[model samples]
Target: MENMRSENHRGAAMEGVKLASEAAANTNRRALRDIKNILGAPHQPQAVSKRGLQEKPAAAGAKSQPSAVGHRPVTRKFAAILQQTQPANAPLAPIGSERQKRNADTAFNAPSDMECSKASDDDLDEMMTNELKEIDMEDTEEEEEEMPDIDSCDVGNSLAVVEYVDEIYSFYRRTEELSCVSPTYMAHQSDINEKMRGILIDWLIEVHYKLELLGETLFLTVNIIDRYLARENVARKKLQLVGVTAMLLACKYEEVSVPVVEDLILICDRAYSREDILDMERTIVDRLEFNMSVPTPYCFMRRFLKAAGSDKKLELLSFFLIELSLVDYKMLKFQPSMLAAAAIYTAQCTLNGCVSWSKCCELHTKYSEEQLMDCSRMMVELHRGAARGKLTGVHRKYSTFKYGCAAKSEPAAFLLDARRA
Candidate 1:
């Protein structure tokens, strides 16, 4: 078709013969393309009727129908039909730049009844398919224009893909349950208690901040720790080894530059050597079967914050609370989604001094104010204790100017009032 280019648009040429030749040339090009396409395909049957074959058996004095059709194959029948049609029109003439003798440029006689009856059903099928494709494309374009796009100002960033974001989060919501460990899994541990686990996390929080890692890397680190501990029993001495090894694995998974074994060992004041760390890494990988991609509160935190149409302060405070919950073992009772939703709810109550769980938040988070009350109350308590608690690593980290002093914000005491009543 591209090779059939000709100057035949309106006012492109004044000669009537040139226009007629151009039209005939385009039609011939289209027909040849269709014929070549059909011939290239496999296992196609001819569209001929059985009427001609039946007459042969009748005239030969055979009383029964033959089990087979006539001897015309698909390619032979198509070639014969096209050849007959070409001679019926006129002698071919060159019309376009690259004319290869396929130009039907002369005037044609009207088709006979037999000629029109010979039209194959393939032409009708092609026309219907083209029309349906056009209609479907138009409908999809309209639907895209009508649907609302929800994302941060970073939609311009190619990494923040708008398409499939909702589906991704919806899948996160459904499978979040599998990511959670038993709330009371600490009871079966022989060496580490919840308090010791909290201390390990507090130290890790400090290490994470000092390393200047991404927020997601921090969350993934904690998830790796909890999941490893849930499946295996570590000795009291090896517990810190687990924390360091988990953080190392998480950095490999989430960061471009990970801390080396020497840096981690130095942080622990050379308590463990390189071989111990390497051995611990191997043990953790084997115990957990290398399943590290799990959703955490940070995943839901970003999403619920977006749904709330939150300002910078609300975002910080929400993150501050969720990080605090990360240090406390009691928060394990709630799924990552619930913990995230409650953090936002508690943050909203603290900042606005009233219930501000909007319909959009509820719809996206799949939780209402009432349903989040228990978790919200727990988060509020963690907030109250953050400034003065032994696990004040999260508080001191958030209180810095970089975090906008999110830790200094007053706790949502109003949520605790309902619990007391």
Candidate 2:
């Protein structure tokens, strides 16, 4: 009986052990089921519709969109699940469908109090793009209005000018500073006299005419000579060499085909050897600091003539006056623009017998009658001197009808008196 009871006890113990093992297995299976529920069904699953891709529904009253520019934060476990679910070689989801799914996910996962419903990121992006386009269009319109329309203007006038307007204006705006030559610069000179300077200028004009060089070449030659004199002391004998060398430098800077050094030597009757000319050229250029950008009265004369409506008579008279200014040392005190304006003013009054500055003159030249009086008086004196044949080169050049002979034409005595007044 004792043996049978021991056997029953052992059998009952074995049965209890089996029941505990089963219970443990059941608990493990229940936990696995809860995990599966949390993560959604794991299987050889079909591709999900974009609308139903999320593992779980978001909490109620959550925002419906994500931030526009930045991305949402994702946890590592979620990324791992994504990596495991999608095969490495599988075709990607269509971009539109993927974006829609991401939008829905972002909206569902967003904080409830946030304003996700205001606009989707894509919608906001499109709206911002349109706003930026409108702003750019407005700016373009304003710019078009502010800047002159080069296309509509005359081709001859506008093409080159409009293309390089900014560069040209920047260059010419420094004219006063670049062209300033001290009136007293010649006071210390020993060998060079004002009469000799005038003669040199007259000869240069003749050479300019003979060579058929551009007006710019003549203007630049004169500029170089005056600037060199301002800085250097050339002996009386080397003066012609200086003039010829200055012309050569000017030709090189302004001409398409520069005059030959041999030709320049011949022009001066071989008074200067090629070596002497070249040596002086370097010396003059060095002393002037290679600042050959002096603005001449001729540059301003052209603008002033155009401002005065390009009157044939007035243009000739103004040209004659400006050229006369070039030969006179006394006229060096005035700026190039001032000389041009004064020339124009004197010419206009001589032609029209007007005492006051014309509106066109004031509008274009930006000078008042009072400001121009002194220079005008000086110009009137030069014109009279030319008329009397004292200033012969300019007088002879304008004596022809081609130049309207305005140099020979005299302003009334009252106009001369007004210049003095």
* Candidate lDDT (C-alpha), each: 0.81, 0.73
Compute the lDDT of residue 398 as modeled in candidate 1. 92
Clashing pairs in 2: 64-107
TM-score versus the correct structure, for each prediction: 0.64, 0.60
lDDT, residue 89, model 2: 98
TM-score of 2: 0.60
Writing each residue's lDDT as its tens digit, candidate 2 over 179-258 gives: 76788777768988877888899888878777878877887888788888887887899888889899999998889988
What does candidate 1's lDDT look like per residue over 1-421, in tens digits? 5444554443355676577768878886543224432222333245535443222334455577554435432343444565675656665532443332232111123343444555555578789999999999999987655433347576778876776788989989888887899889899899789999999999999999999998888898888888888899888998899998999999998899989889999998999999999999998888888888888888888888888888999999999989989899999989999999999999999999977797778878989889999999888889888988577999999989999999999888977886788
Winning model by lDDT: 1
